[model samples]
Target: MGLLVVKNIGLLLTMSNRLAIADAVVVIKDGVIEWVGPSAEFDLDLYQDCTVIDADGGLVTPGLVECHTHLIFAGGRSDEFEARATGVPYAEIARRGGGIAKTVKATREASEDQLFELAVPRVYSFLAQGVTTVEAKSGYGLDFDSEMRLLNVAARLDKATPVDIVSTFLGAHSIPAEAKENRAAFVDDICDRWIPEVAQRQLAVFCDVFCESIAFSVDESRRILKAGLLAGLKPKIHAEQLARTGGALLAAELGAVSADHLDFASKQDAKALAEAGTVGVLLPGCAVSMCKPDFPDPKLLQAAGVKIALSTDYNPGSSVTLNLPLMGSFAMAFMGMSAMEVWEAITINAAAALDLQDFVGMVKPGYKGDLVIFRGADPVGPFYEYGGSKVAKVIKEGSVVVRRDPCGGVTI
Candidate 1:
């Protein structure tokens, strides 16, 4: 049996009902947390071979989980950002054959080996920020060949990166260029052809659709999501980003694990989300990147008692960020969410959105040994330091993955 101990934790954010634990010690055995409590209560001689880590006054918390991101794709869209900043709307650019279509074209052109190399550095960038698990979607590949290749590339990335990757099939991200004239036909092809193939190959865990006025209409969204559900693939929706098209209600109806990009959610959407237990994932980085006039109203969702989570929305066209702290800070400053709220959003709440809350979100006994140790005395420093790296140590499955200046430090 293998054992690991982290002791002398100055501050521990358990992310439980009790919220915080002070002067805590966590014990792990065989990749699962065995004990977590005051240091005085932990027994040192419980295991045979052991490894001890000192977290000395540093903050220890569950590893951050990013529930929504389009991390796998070919090329960059920095040029699109420049155009959008200079008084151009994203929809107008898309009408001119830009946006997802542009990436779709590029992604389809690139080989799997080329895609893998570009994405490896990007995944490491996220890991440097203390992110341990990420849900990556294949929306850039809006066609069968490209979409499948993107998912295949995402699967390949798991072996190449330290961060745990979850892939989703998003063939209905947008109607392809070939199917531009017959959008419904494209939807039918996705449901009949692409989704089945993806499921047969066991490539994706969930299926998603972009439910918007400019993208898929309300009926189309419902139809595609329904097909995905019937195929034994869980459903998720990119809903209400540009307009309130009852996407939240549709997610509730479909029993989706989560619905993301609710920047334009109405009161009814908020109410439906709360009642349905559908996690409301807010992407403030998208707003920051696009310079949108208004951000999502956190108060309305919070008032409705909706479970809200924050994500980087790490995509090429809109949000080019991969840092969860930056996204959390944006949620705090612009969305008016508190630090505690943002913390919960990325940790426990984000885990729940990905259906991984039972093990990964909390640093509790019997949970997956996934936690981060920040360099500072408090957790807030990770955000307050802003652009600097605060990830002192990263532990996944009871194994130390990333450590900074690892001579000697505190452990809890």
Candidate 2:
């Protein structure tokens, strides 16, 4: 809570164009970064009472931000995963009464306490991999009470965990079985009933929609998002994941914060997003889990001047992993993203996706004192060596919250 100093950093990545620095020092006072520079210029004697942490010549960067995740779900989908392995398409699986609907049943059946307990370990997993902030969506709950419960659990997670949990209202995630006969009526329920209540109760920061062939149409998505905007929630869209349904274009038109899973997004969509200043959040983990080789073209997005961010897309049915570094590896190996791009995706760019750029996701002065110290000198070690934990320490709000020993024992 007082003065804290992290000294002797071998390589520091500040998520700027001039990214890396050597022998760096970061000074924090009362949970905010005060200074960052070379250790030689930092005189420890100038500070009378300060707690110092030796980085041991490790890699230091701002704490990772998971901008898109379904972290509040109540069940797993191991069976559905196996079903997909046998060459069944995701759409076919959904038709067979699986996927999001299955998770919805489980989530709706769960008590708030049960959902909170299930989610705490998942948050811990994110923290273990240097994630200090995550955006959790309430998609599994299609109905109002269930959706409100999910948001409440997310709020509890923010207060209970070391990491910050940003909540999104995703009542337009999927059409429930009860409303399958009257899809338009259900859409009305979302816009007219759910969104206003969510806004009035201040339950969520963003309103998101899954705009796809399997979910809501472009027009329906627009209606829901417009209602959210009218009720004071910012817009985010799950766009073009399985197919191109004009979701990205809608996101650009609405000036949403982010358009995610742009596997089918065209260069024109990229240009639109760039013009609108919408961050294109790519999810490589989903591609790997679904056995889909196609990934969002980072080069095309960059060429169009679209800011690209990356996320784990951690969910029950697909992309069920908390390792953001593994996602970086996937991005480089499959999506052709550079290590610097991967780092920026998980840090500053991702924070921009969540509209938290000024608060977190940078090592500069006045940002939150949240950082990760890896076990090696190379800042790209996590992406280079994909599987294992390279994190040695994680600092949140000027305090060391996680420490991993040489033998791989973790203290949190």
Candidate 3:
């Protein structure tokens, strides 16, 4: 975490107001970016003790940020994938106890150590794909004990891995079967008991709810979010994924940081989000995984001047991939977003969704020295290339964490 230098950058995307520089160089000191400018102006005689990283004319950008992910789940849902491939709707499968409930059951049965072990490899997967920071939610455990277990595992993950894990409380993900008879009491438990405990323990920075017909009603979501807000946690919501149930409007009303999975959000919802400065996180992976033709319209959000961000929404039931670039590809191909917009969505815009824009998103002076070096010079290569990782090296806080060799060998 001492002096570090990255030179020979063929193309550098600062992501600060979408600035791009050619033949750039970045200098870091004590895990903070000290200077970033053209290599020609860099004083080679100074800082000879610094560890130099030759970019080899690669494209360098800020480390990718995954703003929405359920990264602490215990089980997989491959069977649901097969069922959906056979034309069964996701909601119908969920109604039959095959969606988040199935994963919740498995997660509740898992020990904290087991969940941590299972999540380490997933964190490495994101690191290899150039994701340096991830917003991991705790929702696979609906009960208080199980939910605490998930958040504990996420905290452990942040220490155990190089990738920064931002924990979010999502106890309102779904209603457990045991609480189905008395949903009001379950909501009360979340509002009165779980939210307070989580806030007191500093277990999460944000409180999130899945506000849909399949999950909590708009009023219930508001109650949960307000409880969290009063407890000093910011608000985020899973809105309009399966249907338009007034969740987006509620998120805007509550001034949530982000409203995600807006597949059914209308233009008015877009306007509300814009006025409220809430990021609209589009999860294209969910649409592709569920075989649903509907996706969040980037055009509509853009027209309304709403900031849009894209995420993998890495979870067991619906989206399972950790490839952020693949999600960017899906955004451009199906959602009518350009390559520049896709880049911004996963970097600066995504950091905004997590309320970390001031610290990590852009490659500028005073920002953390987290960056990704892609193999090619073209800034759009990752989105253009569909399969495999285009990342050659990943740096976290001025230290080399991941390096991929020419023969597909990875060094961590």
Expressed as tens digits, the lDDT of each residue in 214-243 for candidate 3 is: 789999999999999999999999999878
In model 1, the runs with Cα more than 4 Å from the true position are 95-97, 406-412
Model 1 clashing residue pairs (backbone): 6-412, 7-411, 7-412, 54-410, 54-411, 55-410, 55-411, 56-410
Candidate numbers, best lDDT first, in rank order: 3, 2, 1
> What CA root-mean-square deviation does each model show from the true structure?
2.6, 1.0, 1.0
Q: Write the per-residue lDDT of candidate 1 for residues 1-412, one digit (tens) a residue.
A: 3788988888889888636877888888888898888887877787557899999778898989999999888877787788788988766877777788788888888998999998998888787678899999998878778888899999998877778899988888877778889887898899899888988998998999899877898799888888888888889999989878888899988888999988888888888888888898988888867867577777888889888889999998888898889887777667788778888999999998888889788888878888888776676777766756677888887888877664433231
Candidate 2's residue-wise lDDT over 1-412, tens digit each?
A: 9999999999999886646889999999999999899988989999879999999999999999999999998877888888888888777888887888999999999999999999999999999999999999998989889999999999999999999999999999988999999999999999999999999989999999999987899999999999999999999999988888899999999999999999889988999999999999999888767766776678888999988899999998779888999989988898889888899999999999999999998899999999999999896789999878899999999999999998889999
The estimated TM-scores of all candidates read 0.95, 0.98, 0.98
- On lDDT, the stronger of 1 and 3 is 3
Error of 2 at 225 (Å): 0.6
Residue 392 error, candidate 1, Å: 0.5
The Cα error of candidate 2 at residue 109, in Å, is: 0.7
Best by lDDT: 3
**How much lDDT does each candidate structure score?**
0.84, 0.92, 0.93
What's the true lDDT of residue 30 in model 1?
A: 87
